[model samples]
Target chain A: MIEVEALTKRYGSTLAVDDLSFTVRPGLVTGFLGPNGAGKSTTMRMVVGLDHPTSGTATINGRPYAASPAPLREVGALIDAKDVHGGRSARNHLRAVARSNGLPDSRVDTVLGLTGLDAVAGRRIKGFSLGMGQRLGIATALLGDPGVVMFDEPVNGLDPEGILWIRNLLRGLAAEGRTVLVSSHLMSEMAQTADHLIVIGRGRLLADLSMTDFLEQNGRTHVQVKSPRQDDLAPLLRAAGGTVEPDHDVLAVHGLTCEQVGDIAAAHGLALHQLFEQRASLEAAFMDMTRDSVEYGSGSLPPPPDSALPPPPDSPDRPGATEVAP
Target chain B: MTLPASPTANAASPFALDGPVHHPTTLDVVRSEWLKLRTVRSTFWTLAVTVVVMVGFSVLVCAAQVATWDQLTAEEQQANPINGVSSALAGLSLAQLAVVVLGVMVISSEYSTGGIRSTFTAVPRRARVVVGKAVVLGLSTLVVGLVASFVAFFVGQLILATKHFDVALGDPDVLRAVLGSGLYLAACSLFGLGIGLIVRNTGGGVTISVAALFVLPPLTALIPGTVGDQIQKFITSNAGQSVAATGSAPDRLGPWVGYLVFTVWWLVLIGVGTWLVRRRDV
Candidate 1:
């Protein structure tokens, strides 16, 4: 397990990480979600002892990382994919890190094969593509076979197949009862891979919850209804305890499900043309939670012609954009 | 993208991996650093240039001296006799620059390429990493310097032998001068590394190293009087090259004393560098 207690890092006058504390437990993939400049990288750096904490501590396995007799054997972190020397071959680079911890050369070859880098291990890192570099970074992280593994934006430049491979790999790591902390701005990827989430914005904790609770609490869901006798249905729905906001031709109803709205419409003998439930995607929920905390909030753009328009689909597989009648 | 099974998958707990926890010693760090230094092409090329320049320049200078021997009168020859030690080590003035470039690159390239983060992350005791690099670079340069010095000494002596002016290895101060050439090159390498650590930029580190070793020595000559003479005696290159001198002049420092002063300069720079490296965020 990794525990951070009131960890803070200040650069000059700017607070890069401010009084942050979170525990990453074993057997789970904890998603560290944050907007750009939200101290995710700073927090990881402090955890690995790369950057000194101004006034707090980050410990791995109940001791400061620096205090560990064999830190690499206890914690493996891929803080930056491009941190390796470009001039060295992939195999030699891993060997240097391995030798630092007194790890055997056999372990280097194991990680090389594990990350699908065995074929290119002889090649110089400068020749590797971004995706290959990321894979090599992962290979380095797994070199020591540590219990705690952390990756920062692991899938930034991967192809579609590589993305799928990493998602499965993270899940597999967590399944083996290892602590995995992954940070990314991609909400869709987090929604799929993260078992728990620790969300931060502008160097402050905004939310910490499970994947299910995060979606249920922050992701808003509403019923979209259209009717010829919409004027009659509007009051009847509100009187029935559902908040109704009338749009051009549809009524965006909150606090009620599709069945409730349909039951009321049928009871009053009101004609309904279309009715469906619109569940906000995780991306939409994250946007709402961090709207004010964004470091570089783009100036407000004019709202769409319809205020009740549904958020874009979370992923291509979800088909969240298509309205379905039930 | 089928990942092989994780090595720790079958372990009862995440922390319970096989093998005793071995805290890395300084030796381990040195080995790792040696691997780092040898794996790069630049290290090989720089060392190659140092050897070639040191040996090549010595041979050419000795050959030129032999070619001009017959043109001088006996009185003129006696007044300006060829010093075997100086002749064999003449290449050092040029070869030391190559060693300086390689030394600065050893640490500065890590900063430029963002590789320092990986290095620091592996060995959180930041001072140990610096020590490791210093040890590896120092030892390797020392060996190479010795090799280059011996080769230049033998080859230069062989060339001067044609004119019957050759000096043997057992001649007074001849062996000291040859050995001193190696020590001088090693010191030059460390000096460059110290500058590199302090500056943390290849171009800036090389610029400062060259300025200290070459530019400042000559500039000190214009200081005008006893003060100028003293400053020139203590300047980096002048003091460092003193060790390779066969005969000491009254105004110059003793060979060992001059080398000691040169050693002190690098120690100060490297010490400050270690302190900064430990405190600074990678």
Candidate 2:
């Protein structure tokens, strides 16, 4: 389990992480979600003792990460994919890390196989592609078989197959009763892979809840009714205390369930062509909730095509428009 | 698509599947540092150049002096002995550069490649990591340096032996000079390491180290007279060069004192580097 309490990090005048607090429990995948520059990377760095926190504390398994006798054995983190030496082969690079933590050489081979890097284990890291580099980072994190595993942007540069592999790998890690904290800016990806989410914006916690709860609270559901007597249905729905909005050929009813709308239509003996509930997508809910918190939002749309300015009058054909040099 | 079985499915805990986990001692870190230093191609090239410069050039310089021995006047022969151990180690000035570069790379390469984060993550006690690197770099350079020095001494003396003017290890001050040359180069290597830690970038660390060892002494000499003498006594290469000298030069510390002065430069550089490592974020 990972617990962060009142953690704050300030870089110069800007607060990178501010007064953040949350607990990540085991047996589930917890997503650390934020937009760019939201302090996700800084927070992870502080958790592993790479960066000092300005105030407060972060603990893995009830102790500061550095205080653990076997730090790599207690917590495994893949902070950056390009942390390996390019001159060294993949096997030697992992061997050096393993040897530092007193892990057996055999475990290096195991992690290599687990990450599907055994085929090119003897090649220098400089030759590996970005996807392979990510795989190496994952292999390094799993080298010690730690109880807590954290990955920062693990799927940043990956093929579809590689992305799927990591999604399953994260679920499996949590299923094994290990605490997994994965950070990403992609909300749709989080919606699929994460069981719970700790959302942040501008270094502050925006929401700390489960996926189901988030969807239930922010996701809107409305019933749509299309019929030949839509004008009659609209007044009946409004009279029954439902807010009704008219589309091109249908009536949209809010604050009422599909069954209620169906019963109301039947009671009026109105022939209904269609009546169904439309639930908002999680992506839409996420966008709506984080709309005010986005850091780099554009304020207005671009100018129309007709607004393109005419050419300047300094051409040779318009010689009089050009002023003489002083 | 079939999912792979969970790595920890059957295991009760992380340690249970891996058998008993071993927490790394400082010795293990030192061992890993040794492996790290030797595995890179840069280390191999640096050491190879050091050997060629120190040993190969020593033989060539001494051989050239002998070929011109007949043209020298009696006073010239008396003042500059051709058969001493110092003459056998004449190439050290050029060879020192190779050792210094390797020493700086021991730490700076990790910083440049972003590997220091991985290293510190595995071993969070930053002091232990630095100390381990120092121990490995110091000891290996001492060994390689001693081998290079001995080879140079023997080869140069072998050429001198042809003219019946050779000195042996049993000769007075012969063994000390040869052994001291090795110690001098080893100290120079550690001096590079200290600079490396201070400036984490490879290019900057190497430039500063090279300038301190090779450029500053002559530049200080341009000051002239007593002021120059005082400044030159503390310059790392000038003060340290006495260790391998066959005889004492004027206005310089004796052999051991010069080594001690050279050692202080490393201590101060390393102290500052260690302080910064603890205070700064990776």
Best by lDDT: 1
lDDT of 2 by residue, A102-121 (tens): 88889888889889999999
lDDT of 2 by residue, B1-282 (tens): 211223464765333244555667898899878788888999889888888888888788888888888899999989976755777898888788899999899888988888888998888888888899989888888888899999999999888887777888997778888888899888888888889988987799889988999988878877888878888887898888778876667867788888899999988888888889877777
Q: Which stretches of candidate 1 lie over 4 Å from their true place?
A: A239-241, A259-269, A302-326, B1-17
Q: What docking grade applies to model 1?
A: acceptable
> Candidate 1: TM-score?
0.92
Q: Weakest 10 consecutive residues, lDDT, candidate 2 chain B?
A: B1-10
Ten-residue region with minimum lDDT total, candidate 2 chain A: A317-326
CA displacement after TM-score superposition, residue B198 of candidate 2 (Å): 1.0
| TM-score, every prediction | 0.92, 0.89
Off by over 4 Å in 2: A223-232, A239-242, A246-252, A255-277, A299-326, B1-16, B224-227
Error of 2 at B200 (Å): 0.3
Which pairs of residues clash in candidate 2, taking residues 3 or more apart in a chain or in different chains? none
TM-score of 2: 0.89
Steric clash pairs (candidate 1): none
